[model samples]
Target: MNMSPKSFLFLFLFLFSLAFTYGQEGLPRLRISENQRFMITEDCEPFFWMADTAWELFHRCDREEAAFYLKKRAEQGFNVVQAVALAEIDGLQSPNPYGETPLIGLDPRQPNPAYFSHVDKVVEMAAAEGIYIALLPTWGDKVFTHSWGKGPEVFTEENARSFGKWIGNRYKDQSNIIWVIGGDRNPREGTSDVAIWRALAAGIVEGTGGQDKALMTFHPQPAGPGGSSNWFHNDEWLDFNMHQTGHCANQPTYQKISYDYNLQPVKPTLDGEPLYEDHPNCFNAKELGYSLPEDIRRIMYWNVFAGAFGQTYGCHDVWQMYTTDREGINGPLRPWKVALDLPMANQMKHLKNLMLSRPFLTRIPAPEMIPANQEDNTDFVIATRDSEGSYAMVYFPTGQSKAVNCKPLNSRLLKVTWYDPRTGNQIDAGIISKAPSNTFVPPSSGGKGHDWVLILDAV
Candidate 1:
């Protein structure tokens, strides 16, 4: 078929639009929506926070390596990259690839500009790819030394505030920077350590001059597959709640998300660190076996449909930037560079796409819409619906059939469709007469381990 001149022009413009959508450089500053349940751009465009965990991005990867990782994640539909400023593994003692430590004489107030310049480059690199950097100022060990991490406890209250202010000022003008204060550490109640983290957050506010230009949240240590809401949910500076589902398979992620979702002061929440793809179960590589891409698929859908504003995906090797030169922390099987193409990293875009395809602002978790038992087992189905009750999504992690309470959907005739989380495709399940209870059996996928998403739209 020959194209007319008008058709050719339209094709050209369409291609350009696609390029602009993906290739646009700078990001609009993100803010919580008016309802306080989700995030939006400054212009109120719905922002689904699909992030990749790269905790060691600045501390381990060089400039070129950082660029490569950022570009790939952008193509994979990730909008955020979580990284550390003062890394976890010997971050204070070890120099970066450029041979510079973050502080002078292990002093938080005396920041080395040379070392920070490298972090500046990584931030800029991420921004150029239209990605936000969830910047952790320092790993948890610096203040609250637990059993495992490298720690000398360098932070005093005065220096914590100073360092927070200094780092906050350094990237104040950057549109893509989000401050992540706690690096997987929960400060015990009535401890000076709590004061340290609060001071750092206060200094960040002071440094930013309380402009609210940068979004901030805390990354709590998994209280054994627990949430940040357990510690800092009520804290004023915490913009959103983040939960670390940890490396355990079959975590009851919905419990954590639901607990935060219904809190007195409503805030957006997400699984910041779910089971990293390919991570050994419970950090045990030998007996328990590594989690696959489907494990991530299960966590992503369960948490998001249960009322999370966003979700972060991780790979064991990529988080640590593990390579032959360094020890394989937690038994990383591949180098960080090689692990970048893991299937789940690419699959995360599908979840973002599915969420964006529906109503953005008015969506809510509607567990009452599904009749599945909310037990600790892997077969638990999760459900969500539009506030208007026009549409609903149910996630089946192990491909099991479940009875749904269609009356909660408020539709006489319900059009059901099956959405494949793995492939990002929708399969029609035909309209059915709506009753109080509707038994919907998904297509058989042998028995277990296959997952499917059930979408119901009121006709």
Candidate 2:
């Protein structure tokens, strides 16, 4: 078989094209609806996105370990994991803690193919487990530098745009990748960080192949509200809103801010970053250490009931601990594997499934339906009803037993049931009178310290 030179060249080109396309298999290309809904792909329902912080993914361990952690998170019902491309700890720039692979090139300013290869593997593994990665390019590297890697002068507007473009192209077809742009640092108070942010976002949108436009949002510093107000809130590129309720547990303040954002005009919103593991409880001014199961559950339910689309969870070890050895770091370092196994994961799964099972849970608003009395600050309650008016959910956060009045709810035949969120137990159920209003006395003390959910169904 004597083949001509031209024919051989043509054959080589054809094979190369085939290989290029085939290599991209399993890459996620997400699509959003015209109305801004997260297009459900491959039967992926819009269940509440229960998430965890994996800030150590690239800095602490290798690809294999990253996969192991991500898989465990999926098994435990965490659908999303938040991570930073350039971490806050030192020694991550080159020749990582593991000693075999380098984090970046000798010139930290230039892009390293080897480093991105490791990241690609991690993103691919997460997609395999039906888990999405909230990819953050850098931490608050612009404003502060810690033991983690230092930020290149790339923090400037010109460099940020270039960085965003590079990042977008690298992960272009990855469907499971969610682009989160900001770290804890905000643009200089009155400066044009806004212009820099917008430019970066523009580059990301451009680089991400039209195949799947990644959902975009910003991660503001703790206590700062996420959205256009701070940085790129109203930016046309942003698809959703995210807020950090401070590192300390400021439940009341978080509730107030969340309530306000829920009423915002733009797209779906969430508390992307809240208190971390073992952080102090600002309300009580006590060092609670890591977030306990009850604390996670309370925060999650509180956010959802207050009209947040999703809640992001964090752990002290996972957020601040970079190395597997957990040495040289000032914070706690519980193995993320153990953190995933915590009872809080199971609780989140059960509660989220129950809420989604009812349609009314999605349609109601936080302000119109839920009532919080200023005189009795402890009298905060959040309520939601199904679209068909068949069912309603009410969450009471105050530990003390209090009366919840529902005057707007009018149904001839109403049935009230109390359920324990932790155990999924039906504590009690009974018929109620058709009065002008109804008062619900939640079980004060129970499996968890939080008040119980009162489920009302029309008979």
Candidate 3:
């Protein structure tokens, strides 16, 4: 068969497409659900976004260390690994174990192929383990250097676009890639900084050849109530909203997720950077105590019940790849390798299992189903229910007895149980007749560490 020149070219392109897609066939491609409030697989299966923060995975660790770290997270039921390409903390100056920096002379336009090849291997490894990489092209320092972040500010609008396109084209074919912009810095409105990030977002889209292959979002600084919301909520390029509730003790992050949940144009939201398991409260170990396992559990349950699509778990030691040889930032208690086996890391999988065990894609925040309590302290309770009101969950931060308004469930009898966030075990609390208001005391009460989740289902 003598093929024409045009036909020959078309055949070559077709074969290339097949090869590209075949390489990614085993990976799960993710997208925003039709309702725009949660994530689902390409086949519309519910995907609970359980993530762990390891921002320095590529910048700090070698292939062997990276593999170990990833394996532990995979075993812990973490489906997403959030990392940065051009990392924070003098990443531009320091080289990886391979002795390569991401940029030549700290130029955003000049990404070193050798350095990015390491990142590629890491991403591929994560995908092989059924983990998606929520990749930040560059940390916030590259564009908006807020609060003494180590940065030379290498990205202008033009270079930002070129860098983003380069990264987008590089990872476009990967099924497990999620493009997250704005690493801990929000571009001030009416400034050139905003244009820089917007250009980067556009460049990434263009680099993907206009295919929305990966979901996109931003990680703003933990400064105010608004997170990425105040900057890019309405941006066409943004697919979801991410907030950094920060490492403060008892930060009312549920309020933040609740606010984003009720936005006019509904978009999925999550606490991308919650309080880490062992980090100091408010970044001051001397003044404030370290965050206990219960502190981490409280934030995780509170955010999810208050309408967050998922939660990201962080550790002060893990995020920076801390070691005794290196001076610890924010008082890292242990090395990254040791921090990997912390109880909180083991316990995080329970949240994903619990959510998936129940109905997916049909849950909504239902605070009205639980009556308000008069707790003088900041500790409080939050509630959520299936859209049909067949199932509901309430979280008590301090284990105080609270009255619930079961009238919203509309069921004759409700089967209640106590869910232990620490162990992911459930204890039956007996059945109750649905009423206008019912008060239930937890197994224990009045301690910062005693947190409980009340699970109710129609009987």
Candidate 4:
């Protein structure tokens, strides 16, 4: 029988839709190099750091909620998510809030296969969005115990290895997974805990088919750098260094921590967990309230400029919240849910693009490059340059007006532009004088202020 014209058109449209959907499903694999660098097949070098802090995974929530959060993260230009396997609040044995799906019993020493299956789905979904997963096995689970999960007793070398093997085998082939070992805290006895972590690292290496190992790091307690300084800092198993800045909102102190990490000899370092939304500032409790967008930007740019390869952004309530329902388990999702849409996310994207645009064979921060005028203030400045002198980027953030001077490559002929980081807009041509000094005036606005990016190119 001959098909009518209308019928033929409908059939063609349906086939076309399927092809489009299939094309969208394709995603890149994320893997780590021997040097501990995060390697992606796509040219994501000068890697733009787009990350979010969804620290809770394997919580009371279902796989569906995890997928929703991961998908939402990708939509907002977040290519990386920092999450824990045995969620701090919920563990493998935690009750399933959804009565429809009953919890299965599994040895707590080994990862619950059911929970990891959920993790696999989340990782797969993130991969489809070009997002990578920074998977942490347990959140201080090895050292501490609370309502979340059994710990201390679970912090044995054998158990760590078994847990690592289970996880590594599950996603061995998936390149988008980054293995993060430590949580927000460290082990009690330094040597034994290090041994346990090493065993786990070995398990991951073996399970991931070895050689092509996953990028690995330890997440230390607040105000600490992954317990690496004494324990795993230079260990062959560690790929990079990660630090938590605690919940302090003081911009100056937070930025300094980044500067110090930049000086480490290892591959690269980053602030894995910084101050979260609604967290009280340690320095001043009543003076500075929580969830200020400017405070977030200050910490982010400071970390990036100070030689950190990436930064993680998070909200307090969201980081701690887990749910079985669509409406989110925490408080009404008004201000907290909307926090992701804030200016900080867009600003980081713009900076990532700028960094990737330049050819950076080597980047060295020039502390001496900062001018005397800029040195006396609380504002933090970090400068880095490519080897050939073709490109350079400087980030300067000060609560008050400050003049900055830097050594310029061909100062007279360099093309300089000041970037308003808030909107990612560039100001018209500004020149660096032959004397190699430029004056930058911080916005007159008090405490909550703006940062500036100075891009210089040899004309």
Model 3 per-residue lDDT tens digits across residues 227-325: 788878898788999999888876777888988998868899999999997899988889898998887888888889988888899988999999999
How large is the C-alpha RMSD of every model relative to the true structure?
Answer: 5.3, 6.9, 6.5, 4.3
Q: Candidate 1: which pairs clash?
A: none
For model 3, state the Cα shift of residue 203 in Å.
0.6
Q: lDDT tens digits, residues 276-370, model 1?
A: 98799998878889987776788889899989998999999999989888888878888888888888887899899999988979999987877
Where in model 1 is the C-alpha error above 4 Å? 1-25, 224-226, 372-374
Give one digit per residue, the lDDT tens place, for model 2 in 299-339.
66767666666678776666654346656344554565565
Clashing pairs in 3: none
Worst 10 residues of 3 by lDDT: 369-378
Ranking by lDDT: 3, 1, 2, 4
Candidate 2, residue 186: the lDDT equals: 59
lDDT accuracy of residue 174 in candidate 4: 76
> Model 4 reaches what TM-score against the true structure?
0.82
Candidate 1 global lDDT: 0.87
TM-score of each candidate structure, all chains considered together = 0.92, 0.81, 0.92, 0.82
State, as a TM-score between 0 and 1, how close model 1 is to the true structure: 0.92
The 10 consecutive residues of candidate 4 with the worst lDDT sum are: 97-106
Cα distance off (Å), candidate 4, residue 85: 1.7
